[model samples]
Target: MSAQVIAIDAMGGDFGPRSIVQASLACLSATPSLHLTLVGQPSLLEELLSGQSAADRARLTIMPASEVVTMDEKPAQALRGKPDSSMRVALELLRDGKAQACVSAGNTGALMALSRFVLKTLPGIDRPAMVAAIPTQKGYCQLLDLGANVDCSAEHLLQFAVMGSVAAQTLGIARPRVALLNIGTEDIKGNQQVKLAATLLQAARGIHYVGFVEGDGLYRGEADVVVCDGFVGNILLKSSEGLAAMIAARIEALFRKNLASRAVGALALPLMKRLQADLAPARHNGASFLGLQGIVVKSHGSAGVQGFQSAISRALIEIQENLPERLHGRLGDLLS
Candidate 1:
């Protein structure tokens, strides 16, 4: 395969540029043929990498970005005001073919807006939706429209289902089981939009429609791709992350409450860590913007080095798989 290049918004996430810079250096060290272009204040990015060897710096590029869109900035405001923002510049690299993919941990709304404006959407796609992998007992499932479009019609949900199915397919599932996220699994338990979406999915060609899957069913790995509006999907994703953290903390607290428990905890610490790593949200950090003409991934704003690296890894995988091309090719058949 040819060498791969990815552009990163080094100033976008919650953590300072130090963490993003570390992750970028780590990725460069690990992948011999990979190149990174860090879009931010060139001087700060260079200073952060001042200690690196010349070889590492040779493969790295610092693209100057004068402004930054804050994590809480409104999408419209950022779009109108921050033309040279790190997030927008990184995406411009992808749009101009300077890089194969772009990754940003910036404001979700702004990233979505800029990506749509810069990269545009694939033909036949009304809007691009965000899809991220969520851990499941069977393995992992792809959930889409994660905080993209707050309100979606039945047709939009159907489009999300198709895009999500292609995502699963790119991950090597020949025929991914697709399902709609609903309060109840029964046909009669959801709102009209979901019910209508179900009807459309059932009739769509080349999709393995699996009917409705409740929220808990997601953890059970009942479906490979779950479709829902951005409002519900975002809430579900955040709630799941919060719940996992709480459960882990509770377990840790239980073990430290007494001497005997502490002794047992010491014995089980290795196993606990393995389990935690398996289900950690950081392990699946990047969320892809499907239906776009180019590859764009959104990392969690609060992600640390590991999470940010995982986001870059996501962009790598999509680049290798030619994700946007695959989605464009498959949309015609699936929706027809």
Candidate 2:
């Protein structure tokens, strides 16, 4: 097999090439077979790489491009006008077969728009969806349509269920239980769209559809695959992020209340580590934009060095696992 390479949109995140460059070095050190091509302004990317050892610098190739698509720029305007933007250039590398996957922490709308416009979707997949692996009590849960298609149809949700199930399985879950998100567990719950989606999932072949799952059911380990339109999924993801931060802050406050509490906190260091590990977004840093011709991992824009490193490793795993090939094989007929 050919060596798997990833094209990173170096100019695309809150920290830009600094984080991406640090991540590229970490990923290369961890996996020898993977190569990285950083797409951004040569001068800036080179500056980030300047301090690295010569051997480390040899592993990366910088592709110079001046333009950058801002988080606030509309996708259409960026795509049409800024042809050399890092985001667009990264996707182009994937399209041209120079990279196995593309990763960006840029504007979600621009990434999705550029990808769909350039790579298109697999047949029978009406709309591509954003899928993220969120930490759960039991393990990881794959949540789909996280801000891709806000206004979705029943068919779209069904497709998301299928994609999410496949993704969860790829992550080591066997026969992942799929759940449609709704207001309640009753068969009659949810709006017309969700009700219809639940029905479709139940009737869909090759998946373990477990009926509707409420938002509150996520931490309870109700399902391995959770399906919802992007609007709801986005809201749920952001809310969970906020909640996790709040919980961590509360834990810190409690630990600082008194000497007794500080002693107890010291005693619970191991437990705290486990809890922190479970909630770390870096563990689940990669989220595949499903239905695209190739794998595209989108990390959070504000991801730090560790998170960016995790994103690179996750992308390498996707490449090594032949994620796109497996998806194409399993969903080929359905997509056709």
Candidate 3:
């Protein structure tokens, strides 16, 4: 196995360092070739790992970071006010080539701002967009511009499609079918931005542009990659998350309604559990900040150990794929 290093912003999330440390340890144990650097308050990190065996921690290291980026903090404040923040330090490690990628369950806006500031966008790219694997009926679809660029140009939407295509390929789709998320599937349906992006995508090379896909089509896995402006994508993702939770809750409530219902639920419990797991949004937690010069994955801020571990796994996949390098190589063909 090839050696791979990933830096973790241990202090950035809602649950803080404890969950990050646990996820790091779980990932370390699972990936023998993985080396992790936890960037946070050294004391807390050390204490977190104090109970683990030497064998478990053989490839782990702690990098000191005195500050943490709060969930509600403004992006600009996190950028300038906290130079030594765990999020910034973790990105610095990736920038300096100390790690193959960086994983953070950090404030999304702050993560985007700090990453753009520290790593800069790749040549030929205006800004980086966040892409995540959203679960679909057939499997999963790669959705992009997840809260990074709320306002985007037609050109920016084209760029997101290309980036999302690359990410979809990394996740094992050889020729990812890229689509622009629109109000309707018809050519005449969307705003000027959607129409312009569709024209660009249809003409673009190095991607399989399948034209427009609506929200329902997206959930049905009609396309491998779905591109949208951050405003729409973020709302879609959050609403999907909320809907999943509500459905699961309603099912559970149905089961608990009466003893007869509870008995029936007991008989169906295993299948329901599987379905719940499949529907849980946090089951797919990491979103890559595509178009960055380095690999940076943003995890859900409230992710627990399992969710954060999935984020780490996402980073591992990107590292192995050398995603940023691939994006740089393919940009000219897709963007030109």
Candidate 4:
């Protein structure tokens, strides 16, 4: 029998199960083999699932979960105390071979912590990294260790490169060129971590390490995979988010200024749509917690229906491609 792709942790993210359930239903209609098991309290999921077609009702199954790990809750505290939490339950399904993959938009720290506690890592993986897809002039780029490990060693950075390379290949790149994020393009630049990581990456086999890459060089299509510590990556991700929002707000203000400006807005709408489409976060919704035994996609906390759908769709693609086994074969030695 074919594997089932069900969404666990129904009550996660800002939108919660309303958006999640809606997206899961939409995904079921779009993909036949995809079945949805919304893991949450029956009351909440039943409310969300109301007014749906019999077909959708048939495709979805609700498993009772008593607790939810909130965004503010600490990961360690939640894991120890909240035994029936939705995230934990969802992960258990994956571990027990009942679910092929899981997607969550909850507290990232909690998700990572729970994933580690419940799913554990594949052999030789010291730590798992969060990889998010970012827009670039050359289409898209994947940045790793978004918030998985705040502090990393040289070996961890090299693993990020290997994992990122596999991810880039999955996205259609032949052999993703990796660039260690640093203060300068020089080999000896940046802090001790980058310097040490650069040496290791340059000497590493089966990866294309294109030397050091400065912050400003990221968007210029300098490399397909940008490797850095989680702290730096999180800051970079937030900064780009702020920049995109600021630019969008400025454009909206300009369009409302005057009659001529409004007319100009109409003329510029197509170009704006093109740019928006190119940089839309919803287009790249699935960021894998790399090095896990099975796929665990994390969507943005504020992800709406579209972003949630993209996350589910991406999960399906990853499973269909056997991304985990492929990466293991490629980086097994280095991970060892």
Question: Clash totals for all models, in order?
Answer: 0, 0, 0, 0
What TM-score would every model get versus the actual structure?
0.95, 0.93, 0.95, 0.94
lDDT of 4 by residue, 148-183 (tens): 899998888888899999988988899898999888
Every candidate's CA RMSD: 1.7, 2.1, 1.7, 2.0
In Å, residue 277's CA in model 2 sits off its true spot by: 7.2
Clash-forming residue pairs, model 1: none
Model 3 spans with C-alpha error above 4 angstroms: 266-283
- Model 3: how far is 221 from its true place, Å? 1.7
C-alpha lDDT (0 to 100) for residue 69 of candidate 3 = 91
* Top lDDT prediction, candidate number: 1
What C-alpha lDDT do the candidate models reach, one value each?
0.88, 0.82, 0.87, 0.82
TM-score: which is higher, 2 or 4?
4
Task: Give me the runs in candidate 2 sitting further than 4 Å from their true place.
Answer: 266-284
Q: Candidate 2 at 92: error in angstroms?
A: 0.5
Better candidate number, 3 or 4, judged by lDDT: 3
Q: Report how far residue 289 has shifted in candidate 1, in Å.
A: 1.1
lDDT per residue for candidate 3 within 49-157, as digits (tens), equals: 8999999989999999999999999999999899999999999999999998999998989999999999999888898998877778888888888788989999999
